[model samples]
Every structure is written in structure tokens, then in C-alpha cells.
Target: MNFWQSFIGGVLPYIAVATLVLGLGYKVTCWLKAPVNLHWELFPYPQTLGGQLSELLSEVFTLRSLFHHNRRLWFPSLVMHWGIYAVVFWLFFLLVGAPVAIYLGTAGGVLALTGSCLLFLFRLFVPGLRQISTPVEYLNLLFIFLLALAALASGALSDLAFRSYFISLFAFKPHLPLPGSYLVFLLLLWLFMIYIPFTRMAHFAVKYFTYHKVKWGEVE
Candidate 1:
């Protein structure tokens, strides 16, 4: 393998995945070590395990409260979230070499990219959200848009025979048949993984901690 191929296909994935795992582990450990708040707590919480589980699932999957609170925000958000879920599933299909990978993955990629673009624009035009939004938030959406855009372009413009490259990587072999556009996407993906634990993307972890320790069920 050449330098680019060797580094991008061979080494970078391991580094990204390792950073993801270690970074998450470190964050969870820090959360666990932090002093617990035994005094103050939220009211009107769920009492039963099933109820709590259902509530958590609804919040995570549907963003139910958003629908009630802000209809305008909810529509675009729902599109973006469902699109993300589809894209994630499509990624799994790709890894497993599923039969329906191409059709479903293409749909997923298009939905995600379109929804992300709509959300990015929405955030810009909404004066209230714009006032509260951080530079990092804009950057995060832009980064996601760039990733999806690159993936879509790679698939559409080039051959994008990514399966063998992925196969080699998973088998701990070395090869890089990726095109230039895909190279951009993969590099961005690696950096995204590395950055996730430090950003608001870590909300998934934080939610687990919050539900188990603070709000509803007691892990202690």
C-alpha cells in the first residue's frame, strides 16, 4: 500500500475506534467519580421500571417533548433524527454486506443529507436559536453535512467499491482502493469519532447516566 492508503485505510480506523472507546470510557469514569447530588432532584418522575424505560425510549427515539413544545422545531428535527437512524442502519448493512445495501444506503444518505441541510438553514434563520447557538453547533452541523455530501458524491461520481477496503480493514489486512472523495469522507469520519466524546454528541452517554443515577432508576 502507498502512504495515503496505508495511513488512511490501515491505521486511521484503529486510531479512531480506539479513541472513541477510550474517550467514552474516560468520560463515564469521570461522571461516576463525581460527587452525587443526594439533596436536590426533579419532580414528577416515573416510578415503575417499565414506565421509565418507555419514557427513556420515547425521549431518545422520538423527541416527544419537542413536538409538544415546539412544532416548528420538531418537524425538521424528526426528519434529521429519522434520517440519522436510517443512515446508521445503512452503515450496519454495509458492514454486513447485506443484499439491500445499495438501495437502502443511498436512500439513507440522501435523507440524512437533505434533513441536515434543512436543519442547518433552519438554525440560521431562527432568530432565537441563532442567538443561543454556539459556533461549535454550526460547525457540528456543517461537518455532518460535509461528511454526507462527500459520501453521496463518492458513491455517485466514482465507482466507490468500498466493500473490499472495508473487508481488508476489518480483517486486519492493508489496502486502499478508495478514491479521492472517499478519502475525504474517511478522514472526516475519523476526526468526527475523535471529536464526539468531547462535544454535545456525548449526550447519549450523559442520558444513560442521568436516567440511571439522577432522575429515575437508582443504579446505586
Candidate 2:
């Protein structure tokens, strides 16, 4: 195996995983350690564990707050988030040798790509959104778009190929030459895995604390 191939397929996956775990841990630690001077008393806070879980699921799957507050951006945001969720599930099923990973990966790639494109255009052309949008936000959308495109392009291969590739990666075995599209997907995936933890993209993880602790936590 060539050095570039080995590094990309083998070494980089480990680094990306480690960075994601450690970086998120550090961010959560910082948030936990930060002092809170005031408590938010949001109305209709979920009192029971089941209620809280239901509320969390509602907010997550439906983007309930965004729909209520900013209806204009809600559809694309929901599509993008659901696409991300699908991709995550695809990864899990892929590792488990499930055939459904193929469908999940395809759906995720299409939805993510379409949603990101719409969001990027909204941020670029819409007057109100453009005014508030930052360069990093646009960059993040662009990154997702490209990553989804790569994944979609790579989805042409058999699921067995993907399963074997990942198995080789985790087992630290030499990798066979992957197709160009799959290689690109891997590269972008690694970069994204590393990049997200340090950026606002980590909001997915932070939302747990935001909703459960800050927004709905019991007042002392």
C-alpha cells in the first residue's frame, strides 16, 4: 500500500475519531464547569422523564423551535438535520453488516445535499438571512454539500465494499485501493469529523445541555 493510501484509510480514521471524542468531551466539560448566575424559567417545562424525552425527540426530529420562530428556514434545516441523522444511522448499520445501510446512505446523501444547497442559497440571497450569516456558516454548508455529493457518488459500489473497507480500517489491516469517489468521501468525512468538534457544528451535541439543562432544568 502507498503511503497516501495507508495514511488516508488507516491512520486518519483513528485520528479523526480520537479528535471528535476528545474535543467534544472537552467542550462538554467546559460547559459543565461554567458558572451559571441565572436560571431560565421557560414555560411548560417537561416534569417527567418521559415528557422530557418526548420533548427532546420532538425538538430534534422536527426542529420545533425553528419551525415556530423562523418558519422560513425550518424546512431546509429539518431536511439537513434529518439527513445528518440518517447518515449517522447508515454508519451504525454499515458497521453491523446490514443491507439497509445502502438505502440509508443514499437517502442521507440526497437529502443532505439538497438541503445544504437550499440553505447556502438562502444565506447567500435572502436579505434578512444574508445580513446575519457569517462566512463560517456558509463554509459549513458548503462542506456538507460537498461531503454529501461525495457520498452519493460513492454509493454506487456494493455495500460489501463499504463494510470491508471499514472493517479493514478498524482492524488496522492494509487497505485495498478504493474508488476515487469513495476515497474523496473518506477524506472529507475525516476532515469533517475533526472540524465539527471545534466549530458551531458541535451544536448537535451541545443541544442536549442547552435543552435539558439550560432551557428546561429545574431551578435550584
Candidate 3:
């Protein structure tokens, strides 16, 4: 295998995984250690475990709060989130050599790319969204859009080769001669894995705290 292939397929996965784990761990630890000055009591909080779980699932899967508050932005946001969900499942299936991995990856790439494009246009053109959107937010959306596009193009160009390469990586034996498009996608994916923990994208990790500990924590 060439140096770029070895590094991208082997060395970078470890770096990305390590960065993600350590960064998320540090962020969660900080959140745990931070003192709570006020115990917020939102009205009509769920009083039962079932009720709490129901609420959490609703908010997570459907982005209910965003739908209620910002209906205009909800569709694309939901699509983007679901795409990320699909891609996560794709990774699991890919590692296990499932035949369904390619479909999941394709669907995820399409949904993510479509959603990011819509979101970018909304943030750029919509008056209210534009007012609140920052340069960093725009950059984030652009990054996701490009990554998704690259994923889709690469998968189309080299479905089998890419799958074999990733699977081999997990087995401690790297494969070689991946298409240039796949290499680009791999690089972007690696960067995204490392970048996520440092950005608001990692809010998923803190949702438990936000929903259970802060939003609905029982008062002593």
C-alpha cells in the first residue's frame, strides 16, 4: 500500500477515534464538574420514567422543540439528523460486512447532502435565519455538504474497493489502490470525526444532561 493509503486507511482512524473519545470525555467531565447555580423547573415536566423517556425520544427523533418553535427550519434539520443516524448505522454494518451497508451509506449521503444544501440556502437567504447565522455556522454546513457529496461520489465510484478497505482497517490489515474520490471522502470523514467533539455538533453527547439533569432533574 502507498503511504497516503496506509496513513488515511490506518493511522488516521486511530487519531480520529482517539481525538473523538478524549474530546467528548473531557467535555462531559467539565459539564459534570461545573456547579449548578440554579435548578430550573420547566412547567409540566415529565414525572415518570416512561414519560421522561417518551419526551426524550420525541425530542431526539423528531426535533419536536425545533418544529414547534421554528417550523420552517425543521424539515431540513430533521433530514440532516436522520442522515447522520443512517451513516452511523452504515458504519456498524460496514464493519460487520453487511450487504445493506451500501444502501444505508447511499441514502445517508443523499439525505445529508440535500439537507445541508437546503440549510445553507435557508441560512443565506431567509431573513430571520440569516440574522442569527454566523460565519462558523455557514462553514460547518458547507463542510457537511462537501463531505456528503464526496461520500456519495466516492461510493458510486468504488463501492467494493472502499468497503474492503474499511473492513480491512478494522482487521489490522489495510487494503490499497482506493480511488482518488474515496481517498478524499476518507480524509473528510476523518477530519469530521475529529472536529465534531469540539463543535456544537457534539450536543448529542450532552443531551442526557440537558434533558435529564438540567431540564428535568428532580429538585432536592
Candidate 4:
């Protein structure tokens, strides 16, 4: 019934997750709506409108060049990316599939932890690649690690720290407690998510450019 008990055990986290989903949805919608008007006419491949869409879907979704470029470079990057991706889908499943509950949260948390650890290890073992790794990158992975740790800690020693907070947020409770360390970590995590599409973090999208424009050189 105290600050940590109420906040970490209350509404803050659900609000955080919901806000993240809604905000990202809005941003991507706006970007997609605004324009495909700009042409990257650097390549000479001409195609019908249908062909462009087909290629875009295949290269972008399938991550063709992200695979073809160099398996060593792309494989680990793909694992890290797809891991985050699976986490996102898992969240979406939680948002829609059922009422929020401990099982979904725990599973999602575990999955996220596994993916992030793989990425962290990838960067650590791969030489030269570290040059491209930035403070933001380390911070991002560390945030995930902490979140996973928090989830496990709460489940074991700290009971209901994150879960109760989420339930409260979703239920529109006015009062709750939040953990200080968690609050900062969540804020940074949200910032990382918000910054994703706008930054090199968008290599997800850029990989498509490499595939279609540079690797295959199929821009029209």
C-alpha cells in the first residue's frame, strides 16, 4: 500500500505499453500516407506499379538482402531484429488476444529476454562491427535486459511490481506506485521505440533499400 507497492504494482506500465502501441501506429500511418512520391531514381529498372508493390513486399518483408548481403553480418542482425519483431507481435497478441494476464506477460517477457540476449552477445563477439554499435544501441539492449530482470524479479522476490501496475493502468485507476529505477528504464525504452523509425534503427527499412536499390539495383 506504499509508493512502490502502488506504482510498480499499479497502472504505470499498462499506460506505457498502450501509449507505445497507439503512438507507433499513428506515426507509421502518417509516414505511409504522406508519400511514396519521391523517387530514388538511382537505378534503371522500370516496372509497372504492380511490380513495384510485389518487389517491395518481397524484399522488405522477406528481408532478402538482409539475408543475402553476408550471413555473418545479416544473420545475427536478423536474429536480433526478428526477436524484437516477435516481441512486438507477441505484444499485439496480448493487446487483442485476451485480457492481460500474468501468463502472457511472463511468456512475452521471456521471449524478449532471449532475443535481446542474442543480440547483446552478437555485438560482443563480432569485431569491427562494434564500431557501428552506439551508446543508443547498448542502452537499448540494456533496457530490455533490465525489463526482463524486473519481470523475473517481480515474479519471484518482488511479486506484482510490473503486473499490478499494468492492471491498474488498464483499469483507469487514479492512484498507484511506480519503482524509480523501472520508471527511468521504461522511459528510456519508450524513447528507444519512439526513435526507432526515424533513426538508423530503421535499418529494418534500410535493408530493403539495400536489397532493391543497391544489391539488386532494381529501383525504378
lDDT of 1: 0.75
Clashes of each: 0, 0, 0, 11
**Best candidate (score: lDDT):** 2
- Order candidates by lDDT, high to low: 2, 3, 1, 4
lDDT of 2 by residue, 1-220 (tens): 5776777777889999999999999999998988655557848787887998898899889999999998989999999988999988988888898888888888888889999999999999999999999999999999999999888877732355688888787787846777666778888999999999989999878887887778776632
Looking at candidate 2, the ten consecutive residues that score lowest on lDDT are 153-162
Worst 10 residues of 1 by lDDT: 156-165
Candidates in order: C-alpha RMSD to true structure: 2.8, 1.6, 2.0, 6.4
Off by over 4 Å in 3: 156-161
lDDT of 4: 0.55
Error (Å) of candidate 1 at residue 16 is: 0.8
lDDT of 3 at 179: 68
- Give the lowest summed-lDDT range of ten residues in model 3: 154-163
Question: Candidate 3 residues 1-220, lDDT tens each?
Answer: 6899778867898799899999999999999998666657758788888998899999999999999999989999999988888888887787777778788888988889999999999999999999999998998899999999988877742263456776777787766666666788889989998999989999999988887778776633
Native-to-model Cα distance after best TM-score fit, residue 142 in candidate 1, in Å:
0.3
Query: Candidate 2, 203: how far from true, in Å?
Result: 0.7
What TM-score does structure 4 among the candidates reach? 0.53
lDDT for each candidate structure? 0.75, 0.85, 0.84, 0.55
Return the TM-score for each candidate structure.
0.85, 0.94, 0.91, 0.53
Error of 3 at 11 (Å): 1.0
Once model 4 is optimally superposed onto the true structure by TM-score, how far is the C-alpha of residue 214 displaced, in angstroms? 14
